[model samples]
Target: MNARLPERQASRALLIGSSRFSHEGLHDLPATVNNVRALADALTDPALGGLDPSGCRVLTDPTTPQQVGDAIDGVVNEALDTLLVYYSGHGMLNQRGELFLAVETTDPDPRRVHYFGVPMGWLRSALADSPARNRILILDCCFSGHATQAMSGTAPAVSGNLDIHGTYTLASAPAHETAVAPVGAQFTAFTGELLRTLRQGVPDGGELLTLGDIYPALTRALLASGMPRPQRLGTGMADHIALARNRAYRPATPSTVKPRTVSEPRGTTITPGVRSTNEQDPKVAAEFHAAMLDGYRRAKKELNYNAGNFIQMVQQVGGLEAARRLLRASSVSSGFTTLWEKGRLDLAVEAVVLQDRFAGLFSDEELDIARDRLAEYGYSPAQTS
Candidate 1:
């Protein structure tokens, strides 16, 4: 099922790419250009959406705060039908827990983020005020997940303090994590999968690349590759919603195989560049688990306690099953980071691979829960806060 987008309607996208920074300490991102080209090309391809060049705004290496605002305003003004905001740059989380997008002139110091970074709240507010109902934000930067949280409508907004809805914030990483641009890949890991999806189309022969159709494949690719997982909220579309058409797709016979379930456990892989730091050290592993247990006990907050992916794994896949899944991934731990970093593929997998042992850390009881509060964190609050 797909969300019914306005047929034969015009679509507009604001593509912002910040590859270089004025500060010497900040790393330059050469792959952002590749992301912009790939996204614009995919959106513009005749076989896909065929959006006219006039409708899309492409901004590169914008430095001023007003420049970012103006570009977003342009998209909001054009949001009569479909609109997408794609930003590839630095994403910072300040001491106040607010998120800012780093511009070309952004200061390297975290304390000075307010002066140099573009307020993420501005985009949220712009999208909320826009007449358009279908809005999508593809944030490919560090702490980009912060966009999932609704920005406080105040002058300097913090996420999750407000209640804004209807925008799909597809973030490249969880809070506090950095999105990686692989050494050999032409694009960032997050955008590379998106490009591949556009090129290959869904396993199903549907020409339209709906969010639902692409999500599983994306998760599989990123999780298998051990990169920061991209997250999405089913905003504006209760079902699959068309973003672009699959250029390479054609009609085909219906298959017997079913699509992967969202609740199903995903395979884990050791991510590239993850150091072996303390991975094999028993004392370090013990200390990490101890801290986790202590924190959960102290908080007495189920939200915080179960917020751990490991616990979520247990809940979704059952204690034994989750452990088995983790164990399978651990044998090939070269791709995963150390356990101290909250990596799933840990050396301790062997010891906790049983339900009885794992349950000691987390309960086996079923949860009939509400996603309302969690839904508020549409941006990716789990990453930083």
Candidate 2:
């Protein structure tokens, strides 16, 4: 079941690509061109699963920077519910810390170069002018630091310190480093990872992947790919901001499966009649249990709670199962109760996995109690006899 937020309207995105430039001077121009087209193709491709191409409006291979700016102007002017601007090309930084797109101009002098690219200042201003509540800007080009530098001063102006409501800028690399492109690939490593995660969909508490869920996955995937880690500029609260504004973003939600229950006896301390067994590392199980308790406490205080958050914390402690039961136990909206119940057995397995981790941390009696509680919830421990 797709979790529905307050808003039900489909979201709109604007994809802009500048591959063939009028200017012949920039290095790696061909790669930049290809990457943008590749990114557009990825977004439009149905195989990616989550993102629907019907929601996106793409503009590729703009010959001039003005054409790029014009494309953005048209999208923002429409005042769509959600606006995403993606640019892959050359970026330049001036002495004043201003970032510009390398645009086409007759003058070629490096000192007085007419930066043909759209100004970071103008992009931000355009977002400000738009009626859309969520504005996302992704830049995959060289010398992109200026983009962040331009938006730094405005970060504080956003509500709740979240960047998603305003103009959120994601750069391919830091200011000092150069963005890299692989042969035949259209996008840089960082952009590719970002697209992959967004397309793959994140695992939210139970099959519901939110914008927040995708961010970490994207970050981890990019780093794991052994590519240049893109620098995320602007406020770090983009996802939160987007959610707060009720924008249309897709979430990945997994199907529910029934849980199998198992029971055992207490042998050593508690009741002298408990035995437990499971396939999990004892130390990891203990840590997973501790993390769940800690996360529960934190969630209660924040009043900003979700079963997925707890599930994620538990998984971090051990594995997927451990997180599932904690999620079932936690208070969820009525719509999600059936999902939790169906997956109860899987959650039990997770608890057992965590119990194994806790074995070494607690005394025999404590272990028995933990094991019993898990059993009470339908998780069967490994056979000791």
Candidate 3:
């Protein structure tokens, strides 16, 4: 029998990623930013993890341990069924052989690390004390396997006794090995595979995905890719807990399956680097219009705008129509910089219009305008599209 999905209202997840570090020795990891955001989206997706948006919290480039600790405690206090904590960044080992997760302000020096870095022992204690029945810790960083070493009895005595009763710990690499963050990639290699597994799902699998289902798959995929094999430590029924709905599940009746024609046009031939001009079916068009409006509203709130200029444009012309007009304009829009500053250039009308799923909805010229405008703001077609 497959494991059960966590109840949406009773579960909480905290996703933390640090891309930039203040210490001179730690190089920036631009991909970590994308990792957290994409994972948050996947976890909160209605058809995937089914977690409520409010329950999935994301912290990018957190500066201090207290900030992360507070966020973790906040969720741990609220979660009744499941509590998941994920971290992606540099993992450091101090002189005493204790593992620490590097934050933006973390110093590499052994003495200073104790004060700046977030200790893995702290997380162990929190998980041990958490009231949630199911606890999960996924660490994607160098030396992350040390976090689970306590379970094997090779770690410090204090850490060995700190293992939680009902927890599943998944580390990206072995204790001494460094995790891969491929150059120019959208995510760290380990997390990229994790996201791919969630998005693509296991073929011919059960209705829901359990840790038992995902762990072996990840091991095989990572080894085949020549990446480091992951390490997992599960206590009690942790492996039986479902994390996501299987996307690849098929029913007995073929006719009952909905065709995926809405997201990708069936007969349309689109050119490379250019959007197709084909008109969509009414249902598809209506959905695209709604998404455009929704994206606009989110951008307004994210930008914290009180001025009605952009809102008026969107209201009068409709979001998609306004996007069409914006794409055709020669000058960059005023809101582009602010959106970019907030790491939400994706919310900009120009970027939103270029989504891959909306490939056939816009013309080549209009798409070019969107692409060019985004290029001026430092987004390449690969990043925007």
lDDT of each: 0.59, 0.50, 0.77
| Candidate 2, 262-301: lDDT as tens digits | 2333332222323334224465455556655654444445
lDDT winner, 2 or 3: 3
The TM-score values for the models, in the order shown, are 0.63, 0.55, 0.64
As a TM-score, model 3 comes out at: 0.64
Q: Rank the candidates by TM-score, best first.
A: 3, 1, 2
TM-score winner, 2 or 3: 3
Off by over 4 Å in 1: 4-9, 151-166, 236-239, 247-385
lDDT, candidate 1, equals 0.59
Model 2 stretches with alpha carbons more than 4 Å out: 1-10, 22-24, 31-34, 41-55, 104-110, 113-115, 154-167, 202-209, 233-237, 240-385
* Per-residue lDDT of candidate 3, residues 267-322 (tens digit): 67766545555544665566667777777678667666432455677778866677
Candidate that beats the other on TM-score, 1 or 3, i.e. the better one: 3
RMSD of each: 13.8, 11.4, 20.6
lDDT of 2: 0.50
- Candidate 1 lDDT over residue span 1-385, tens digit each: 2334333355678999888898886888989888897888877776666567777778888878789898888778766766788998778877776778878898857688888889777877777777765667788998876676543233245424433344566788876689888876689999989888877776533556666556655766887899987765544232245666665565644593233212211222223223223335455445445543443343334223233445555556644455345433301121111221233322233323211222222221110001111122121112110
- What value does the lDDT take at residue 364 in candidate 2? 45
